[model samples]
Target: MLPAMGDNVVVSTMELEKLLSMKGGKGEASYVNNSQAQAMHAKSMLHLLKETLDRVEVEASREMPFVVVDLGCSCGINTINVVDVMIKHIMKRYEGLGLDPPEFSAFFSDLPSNDFNTLFQLLPPMPNYGVSMEECLAAKNHRSYFAAGVPGSFYRRLFPARSINVFHSAFSLHWLSQVPEAVTEKRSSAYNKGRVFIHGANEITAIAYKKQFQTDLAAFLRSRSVEMKRGGSMFLVCLGRTSLDPTDQGGAGLLFGTHFQDAWDDLVLQGLISSEKRDSFNIPVYAPSLQDFKEVVEGDGSFAIHKLEVFKGGSPLVVDQPDNASQVGKALANTCRSVSGVLVDAHIGEDLSHELFLRVEHRATCHGKDLLEQLQFYHIVASLSFVQS
Candidate 1:
C-alpha cells in the first residue's frame, strides 16, 4: 500500500517545470519542429470538432462575436489549422442558416511558460493577419479572425463563467499536473524503481499514476464546465489505451518507452549514466483507457459524451513499407525525439542527449519496420457537450 497523498508527500515543482514549450529566439528547436505527430492528431480531430459545431446552437448574429478556445495550444501551427477549420465550418453553418457569419475571437491557451511570442509570431499569415488583435478584427476583407494567447495551465480555470463557445485540446491532457508523489517517495510502496514510466509496471506504481490522471482530469472537466456556455461543445484528442490494462505494452508510447529503456540500460552498463538517475526519472504522462474516460465524464455529469472513438495510425510520411526497416526507424525516431527529447534531456542531462537518441534510432533500426506495423498507436477523439439543465 502506498502512502496516501497528503501534505507530507513531496510534490516537486521542479519536475513539472521542465516541460518543453516552443520558446527562445530563432534557430532554437520549437515544438513546431518536432510536433508532426501532434499535428496529425489535431488534423484528425477536425472532423469530430466540426460535427460537434454542427450540433451546437449558434446565435449567428453578425454583431455577436463567436468565441473559441484552444486549450493546451503548444505552438500556433496546429492551433492555426484547428482555428481555420472552426472558422470555415462556422461560416458554412451560419450560411446554411441564411445568417451572416459573425466575427471570431479565438483564444490560444497553454501554460504560462509556453512560447506566446513565438505562437503569436507564427499565427497564420492570412488576409486578416494584422499588427494587433484590434487590427485583425478591423479587417473588412476575408474573415474577421482575432487571435490572442491565454497563458495558464488548463487543469484550472483560465476563463470566466460561460465565456467560451467551443473548446478544443489535442495531444495534451495525458500529462498530469505533477508527477505522483508516491512514485517519488522512497518509503512508499508505490516507489517506482528501475523504470522511468509505468509501462506494465507493478500495481502500486500504476495505481499512483492513474490516480494522478483521474484527479487532474476531473479538475480539467470541472474547470471547463464552469467556463463553457450551457450548450457549448468541446472536442478533445489525447493519447489513450485500447485496453483497460495499464500494463499493456502494445501501445506505441509504451513500446517506444521499452526501446528507450533498453538504450538507458545500455548507457547504464557503459557507466555513462547512473542507474539511480534513470530510476528516479519518470515522465508525468498517463494514457487513459476509453473506459477510464467514460467513468470520468459520467461521474462529472456536466458534459454528455456524444461521440468517442479509438483508432490506430502512424505518421503520414511513413508509408506502410514493412520491409523498409531503416526508413521506418528514422521516421519513428524523429517523431519521438521531437516530442520527448527535451524532457529526456532535462532528466538525464543534455550532454548525453545526442548519444541517447542515436542509440534509440539504432535500436529502432534493429527492431525492423515490421515491428512498427505491429505497434498500435491508440488515439482517443471525443466530442462532448455541456449538459444544459
Candidate 2:
C-alpha cells in the first residue's frame, strides 16, 4: 500500500474555482498545463535524469542487479520514459567499455489515484527493445517482478535494504497532505487576502508551509536512505516556487498563481461571496524553491551530488501552440468537475458561461515561451548514493 502523505490538506472545486475565477480561469487545467509545459519539458528532463543514472558506478557482475525505484511514480509513464532514456545512455556506456552489460530491477510506485492504466496494460512478453532497458526491467536472475506498488504516499517502506541504485521522482515531493500546525487557527497569525485572489497568505503562513515542506522532505529522505545503496543514483524534477509570497507576480510560477488570485478577487467584489466564505479557503500551491530541494537532498546524508541543472523544457514539441479556446474550455470544464453537484446547481449560471469566454481569449495570446517564462521552475536532477559509513 502507498503511504498517505497528506491527510489534512483539502481543497474542493469551489475553493479552486475561487482561485480559478480569481485567475480568470487561467488556473484551470490547460492554462496550468501551459504554465508548466510539462509534456514538452519532460523530453529535456529525460536527458538530465539519464545523466543522473549514468553517474552511478555499477559493480559489473550477475551477482547483484542494479535496483531503480521511482518515488511518486504516478501511473508509470514518466518512470517508464525515464528508464528508456537511462537504458539508451547505459547501453552507449556499456558498448564503450566492451563488457557484457549488467541487469537491473525497477520499482514503480505512486499514490493510489494515479492512472496506472497507462503503465503496461500489457508488458512485452519478451525483450522486444533488447538493450539497456531490458536489463533494468526483466532481470536475468528472476528479480524482475512487474508490480503495482500502490500506496497513498511514498513515506512508507517498500524496497529492500541497500537495494536501490537509482531513484527518481518527478513533479512531486513539495506538497504534503496537510498544512503545518503553525498556520492553523490556533495562533491567528496575520493573514492578508491576495490582491485579486480570494485566498489569503502571509509570511508567517509561508513560514508554516516551509516547515511542512522541510518535515515531509526529511521523512522522504529517511525512507529512501534505507533502500539506496552506497553510491546510489537520485534524480528529482518538480514544480517549485521562486518566492514565498503568494502574490509575487510575474516569472513563470508567480505570475501563474497570482493572476488566478486576481481573477478570484473580482468575484469577491461582485458580491457572489462574502469575505467570511473566503476566510477558510486556501488554495494550496506552496512550491519549494530549488534551494530548498538541494538543501533537502544534500542535507539528508544519503548520496553525493553529481549534477543539478535548471533549464527551460522549451523543447520544440509544444511551440506550435494549442488552440487556446479549445484547451482553455476543456480546462474550465475540468475545474468544474471538482465542484459538488449541489453547488453547481446553486452557483453556476449565465455568469459562469460569460466569464469562460474571456478566459479563453487571454490564454490564446499568452501562448508558448511567454507562458512558460511565467513559471521559473527548476528541472532538478541530482545523483545520490547512500553514504558509506
Highest-scoring model, TM-score = 1
Give the alpha-carbon lDDT of every model.
0.72, 0.49
Model 1 is weakest, by summed lDDT over 10 consecutive residues, at: 1-10
Model 1 alpha-carbon miss at residue 285, Å: 1.3
Q: After superposition, how far is residue 333 of candidate 2 from its true place, in Å?
A: 8.4
Could you tell me how far off, in angstroms, the CA of residue 36 lies in candidate 1 after the best superposition? 3.1
How far does residue 204 in candidate 1 sit from its true spot (Å)? 1.6
- Cα RMSD of predicted structure 2: 7.7
lDDT of 1 by residue, 1-389 (tens): 11212322344644354354443333323456556666675666666778999877788556767889998887647787778778778767777888866777889998776767877787754463334433543444433477788877898889989888899888788777887888867788998777767886788888888888888889999999999987799988878887777756346454557667777878888998777666766767788888877788889999988898785545423435767888666655665665566666666666676677778778878876555556656777789999986
For model 1, the local distance difference test gives 0.72
Model 2, range 212-300, lDDT digits (tens) per residue? 67777778788878877887767776555444353341233333244344444455577664444433334333466667667877777
- TM-scores for all candidates? 0.86, 0.68
Error of 1 at 214 (Å): 0.9
- On a 0 to 1 TM-score scale, where does candidate 1 land against the true structure? 0.86
